[model samples]
Target: MSVDKLDMQSPDLVYQNIEKLAESFPNCVTESDTGKAIDFDLLRQELSHAVVEGNKERYRLEWPGKKEAIVTANLPTTKTLRPLLKESVDFDNTENIYIEGDNLEVLKLLQESYLGKIKMIYIDPPYNTGKDFVYKDNFAKDTQEELFESGQKDEYNQRLIVNPETSGRYHSNWLNMMYPRLKLARNLLSANGIVVISIDEKEVHNLRKLCDEIYGEKNFAGEIIWKNSSKNDQDYISTQHEYLVCYVKDKSINKGNWIEKKEGLDEIYKAFDSFKKKHGEDWEAIHQEALAWYKQFSESNPIFSSKHYSWLDEKGVYFPDNISGPNHGQYVYDVIHPITKEVCKAPSSGWRYPESTLKQRIKEKLVHFGKDHSTVPNNKTYLKNTEFQSLTSIRYKDGRVASKNLAKLFGENLFTNPKDPDLLCELFKSFELKENDIILDFFSGSGTTAEAVMKLNFETDSICRFILVQLPEDLNETLRTASGGAKATITRSIQYLKKFNKPTTIAELGKQRIKLCSANYTKKNKPTIGFRVYRLDDSNMQNVHYKPQEYAQANLDLFSDNVKSDRTADDLLAQVMLAWGLPLSLKIERLEITGKEVFRVAQNSLYACFDKGLDETFAKEIAKDKPLRVVFRDNGFKDDTAKVNVKQLLKQLSPETEMKVI
Candidate 1:
């Protein structure tokens, strides 16, 4: 907790210092008095090495073969085009995306284009239930080889039968499966973003500790309890609730507010009318009844008005709220009610507005009168618009209502559990989303996040987009068959099928509404392929013998042509932008005015250029904006003299910007 003890250095240095501190405070360092020295040093070394090894292994798998030509590329360039069958869904217009594959591979693939940009991520991962199978992650094999061996023809490479009870290291297997994916996911989160993971009692405690280690204990938000099931089983106590552990990327940034339902003026008017009908125009009786009703309402709806008061002479009611405060000095005065022509007293607390304003209200007949017009003195009261009230937190019960509706739309429960689209919609509504804000969901089960985002866009007329990722796991066929005879058969089929007649056997009603979505869907002008796919490969440099003149000519030609046909450089820059997970509308400007071409990416605040034979003055001009990041080609400098002092020049000119050369 002490700032001085933190060392205020890099992670490696801080960790080393922590170990030194632990040695000094042995009793405090050890959780128990076992007298055994804590292995903090060993643990840190193992963890750091493991992370490095995992990343290195993944890189090798992604880029397995490259024989000097450098023909291969990282990430997928071949797009998969599929038909848009559902009229309700528009794949191209919607910002949301649903990718079917192993989450591990998907996360790794995303690392090249989406790092540190996600805002809010919510995932319901496999709970490692004793019966559940753990993900079979073969970190050793090459990606292509692994895919081939798994017998996955145009699908996820492999599947493993992971029964926790039978596994030698149940907890360890789950940890290994989650570790790298979480590490990569953390890299994708924006600094102010938060991630929520839904788990059961079985692994809730373990997951909490794991997230703390990954996201830091300081970033841990509270655990939310979601009552998933309502019915009680007779055999034993029925399990109902699940836990959602939340953690933020950084604790310093504001996370905004949660969404809540609003009680409109119509509802307030209804309450008033009900109260008046039950308890006649007696001011005291009406006030008492209204107060009781409001209290009951507030118990269920936390955003309800707290204070209630009856109008002085009228049967109407109002809540005590400060319309104005102590800024403007005493402009207090009396006013006459327009209807009753009775004089109303201004509060001794001072009029809410200046005397001029009070006069304007009197002229406009905005004041009210009492029931006993002649006997009771009227007082000026401020009217607060109910619409302007602040929204409150929406509870889990409200979320369930929305989730049930979505369940009905799918016909059958397509997913064991789906997030309440309404809850997600509420969250989206709270933010001032632009058409370009890219929402991501790495745990996209049945694509609920995409559906929610699309619905929000339809309702708010905003063009916010989404990116959804889900592993292709086959549904249980037996359950489907039991649910609905022939209809169930269609649902259980691997290929998409339409249903014809309901309440009829498969033999009785031969007709079916089902139609299989095309594997590849193409546009009119462009190829049917949906995505541009590229595979990772090594650099194209080979060792060989050549004459000095020939070598120099080849080098010069390569350097010159590299500027003209530098697809690799262009692709790398694009991937970097994607890795950063910036919006697609981010500006890209290419300038060739200074004999060397430079690319300026406006959104990421980055400028990169790999042109050879660069000019020094041109470089200085490009560095003027103090971009957050800047990259230059190692071979592009005018000379070694120019390259050596470039760092110093940038340091003095753009102190806040980070400079790197490739």
Candidate 2:
């Protein structure tokens, strides 16, 4: 029996696209010099109802390097994520993940494992304000070599280069950086998933057009205007707002509305509880007390509007809604006054509900009646029942509050302009996500997205998890060019990192933020506060593993082993998991069977062993568990006979098991 060797590379998008086209139009597919390819002329004819033409003028957003961006997205990467147990909080059990690498490479590597699994994605990428840097993705070299040359592998020089306005490709640079990342990110979203991108005026228009191309114009959800600043320091207009562009993966599957639970409800409920205790069903007295409570808040406060629902009863505080129907009229019916025992005056339009429903409401004490029959009865709309509101298109919040809170959390202004966790918490609540839904943020700066998800989970008693990816941007290098307050802030951040002997990188600061957020939660209110840390690096496999045919027979003994010398069992396990399309967050358990170490992931889902000197005893012992898939090192067998014996043993025992080697 011959064992298959796993090709440790990301899923090939070009090949996947070819398969997708073949499924729809098999006649339009043809074989090329390289592989199966699409015949564009035939495909166009298949799509067109009339005659197909060539090079027709059409509206589209284009720029220099756009083709390169598309190529960058389709190209597969062999880079693998190595688990860092030393930097991780809860390496084995945590479902959350933190990755340090160029997000483009990370997104490519995650394509298979997380395909159509992510529920939501929120990114706060650089807005291209001419001062901030944009990623310089090199399409010529291997990803590992490119990262090292650009300073992203060992340092952070090649990845981030400032795009000044004086440059010829100012806008093109930003678009090129964002295009490939967004393209890869779209493949990870579920059918009903959504993605929100934050941008300023500088790139908002371009961003919308770019998104329109990537995510079809029909799937455009809406744009949210966040008015967060009040500065008046512009030349022509004082810009005080940034935008949040939202898009759904497939608009057909997203049928539910986004609603936000109104804030200050807790305070109102607490006050009502106190009044009910003191007055004991005396709604009039409670109404007077509530009126006095409303005086404490200014009109600008959101809770001040709650005073309209002042009427109280045994049921709770309620607003007396109009019984009249909307527009012209509804069901015309007469409601009787319970006190006067007479027919109440009907509304000019009609009753909002039908007679049967109105009678049921009157019986349930959900309708309010006047003392005399001359007035129309009102609907008792309880505050407790109307606690949710539709999310608005515009939001107003002071941006400085987030900076202040971050300062308080770290005892210094270590980060500049961090996002408000509270705001994101409210925004996430609007999604009404289900348990274990994942939220991803590739440009996770300051780790605010992680903190926001943690806070949301705690408040809602949810199990939603987050995956954050960030480059390890060196703060010391940034400090060299920073001036005034920016330089001082970097200095303070460097000093803070030195106290813990941590590297001075933005990723280190983000990890600390997540750790602090986790620590702040009490043990009783646990919400999966820990996360597994992974750093993107070269694949665990050696060059010979990928191209064994290129090597001559003379070097067969010299290149017998395919794995890197420095790689550990855990590293091999990680690469195997990726190759098998298993999530890195799955539960990992180490087992020792027949004196050979083995790793079982997510129970019987997969099993891997890289230990040497494997024999039939080890294979029989592992196969007894009946794993669905298993992998072993190619050079682990004691001899050719032992390898043959092990394969026969697995086939005899676990006949359904799919076995592979690397």
Best by lDDT: 2
lDDT of 2: 0.83
Q: Report the C-alpha lDDT of model 1 over 369-459, residue by residue, as the tens digit.
A: 4453453232344333333323342234443564455435544433334566665666566544545566777666545566566567666
lDDT (0-100) at residue 48 of candidate 2?
Answer: 89
Per-residue error (Å), model 1, residue 452: 1.9
**What are the per-residue Cα lDDT tens digits for candidate 2 across 1-662?**
99999999999998888889889999876544343568898899898899888667579986677889999988777678899999998788899999998899899888878999999999999998887778988868776876765555444334777777756578888899999999999999999999999999999988999999999999999998887889999999999988989999999998649997777678777887898899987767887887777556425554346446466788877778887888566777667789888889998888888899989999999898765999888999898898988887777778989999889889889987777888888888898875999999999989999989888877777888899999998886677657788888889999999999999989999999998877665358454478999999877777734322222112323435678889999987877777677899999999998888999999989988889899998988988999988877778888889988988898999999877766
Question: What does candidate 2 score in Cα RMSD to the true structure?
Answer: 12.2
Instruction: List candidate 1 segments past 4 Å from native.
Output: 1-94, 141-155, 160-168, 227-229, 234-239, 255-394, 398-404, 411-413, 431-435, 476-662
Ten contiguous residues with the weakest lDDT in model 1: 507-516
Error of 1 at 234 (Å): 8.1
lDDT of the candidates, in the order given = 0.52, 0.83
TM-score of each candidate structure, all chains considered together? 0.50, 0.81
Superposed model 2: Cα runs more than 4 Å off? 1-56, 141-158, 271-298, 302-310, 325-378, 525-528, 544-559
